[model samples]
Target: MPEGHTIHRLAQDYAEAFAGTEVRVTSPQGKFSDAADLLTGGRLTRTDAHGKHLFLGFGPAGHPTPAESIPARPAAPGRAAPGPATAPAPAAQDHDDPDHDDTAPSGWVHIHLGLFGKVAFGPVPAPPPADTVRLRLVNDTAHVDLRGPTTCALITAPEKRAVHDRLGPDPLREDADPGAAHRRISRSRTTVAALLMDQKVIAGVGNVYRAEVLFRHGIDPYRPGRDITPAEWDALWSDLVDLMREGVRANRIDTVRPEHTPEAMGRPPRVDDHGGEVYVYRRAHLPCLLCGTPVRTAGLAARNLFWCPTCQQR
Candidate 1:
């Protein structure tokens, strides 16, 4: 399954390409004919994502707020000085904002690309694969195809609320609260591996990040979440935010540092970088990047879990 980073990136791309545009929505696959009608001729106001769920908000004549609407500003002063008679400082505003509520369609559509789903953008003149196309949204300049998505529907405000209510904190959201995720995970007696995979515990974390985070923190996946110290949990969340941010920017999960690349310099290939750019993921039975111990793998939560026995001892 595509991780949170991938979903976040997709949301960003969709927002840029289709948001604020009146799109001709269609169900080429015919499975979503009813949902397509609710979205056809609707304007895409914004694209929002939480964990693995992607919400594409469509509004009527009024444009929906873009994700960038909530610009991050410094906290306001606790109390404005009692006397503001003097020239009041110009009202603070986010100058960096480039978003606008432009003329567009008024409708809403939401899609969740479960595991194998993907989207592609092309000019309207170009043709798309008719067979695999699940949904298509087009404007004058561009068209987006939703292929293989697990869920694609026209969602009302109440429906969106219900979906968000079921999810835990999403690390990719700007307003995400790691403390909430930490507290939730801390209460679970489930194995850290299984707990990490639970969307309700922390949205957007998949098997890859799960194994990598545990290995990075030297925490055993077999350990119960309740056994993890609060400080450790905090560190895990912090590290995940950092790692996930990198993944979003790079569009790939890279646990190994570039300097660690085997052909990076004059040095001969390092054993770990024989194939290059990973610590243990898919490098099972290979030598560890930190210690030279052979990387090991085992089945955890029905997925292959990789780690260095020496580096991540129980």
Candidate 2:
């Protein structure tokens, strides 16, 4: 699964490229034609994400008018309507937002690049392959292909409401409450590793963040969440906020400190690529940057867990 950082970047890129403009939505593979029709030609008002899910909303225009009141104009005289035009469709609102007019709704296409899914941006004429193309969105200057996403949907206001209702607060969201996260963590008896991956407890955190956070506070991953002290939980939350923010800004996750230069840190640590960049994720048996203790690994919750045994002692 692409971690929270990757999803966050996808959301940012989409919000910048496509929000507030009419998008040509299509399911190249024809598997998502029904969902695509709900989105084709609709202005992408906003792009939002929660944990592993990406929500993209499309409708006739202006902030999605009530489904029952949108004026469904007759199809362009002779041109047949491509798909079902739901309730009342809004008038074609001009893209005149003084704040951003040049940008197109190229990026607002919600994508959940699951484990094998990914996205690419550029003027390249051809994409990876048609077999892999799930969804494609285009504007005058850009093209976005959602390849291999595990889940893709054309959500409406009510569907979006349901998604948020079930998700835990995302650490990256401006309104995230660490106090709430602490309360949840303090209540779980699950291992720290499992707790970290629970979307209902904290959104956007994955295995990498889990290991880094545990190591930063010198907490053992095997420890039950309830066994973690309040002070330790406080430090974990602070560290995670700082770390996740840095990731959002850099578009990459940097778990190691600069002082621990790659060279000074010794050999380029081995990691299970798993199709992602890494530090301690798979650097098992490698030396810890802060201490000489060798990094260790084991399976937890069916996912590989990495740690510096000596540094993150029980």
Cα RMSD for candidates in order: 8.9, 11.4
> After superposition, which runs of candidate 2 have C-alpha atoms over 4 Å from their true positions?
61-111, 124-129, 263-279
Q: Give the TM-scores of the predictions, in the order they appear.
A: 0.81, 0.78
Q: Candidate 1 residues 192-238, lDDT tens each? A: 88888888878888877887888888887788888888898888888
Clashes of each: 7, 8
lDDT of 2 by residue, 1-314 (tens): 76676665566566456655677777878777887776777776545566666655454544542222222222343566332441112211122122453322222234566687878765434454475678877755567887778777554444455665676766665556767777877788888888888888888788888887888778788888888787887788777777776675556676766556456655563344443334467678876777878889999888889988887876
What is the Cα-based TM-score of model 2? 0.78
TM-score of 1: 0.81
What does candidate 2 score in Cα RMSD to the true structure?
A: 11.4
Q: lDDT of model 1 at residue 103? A: 28
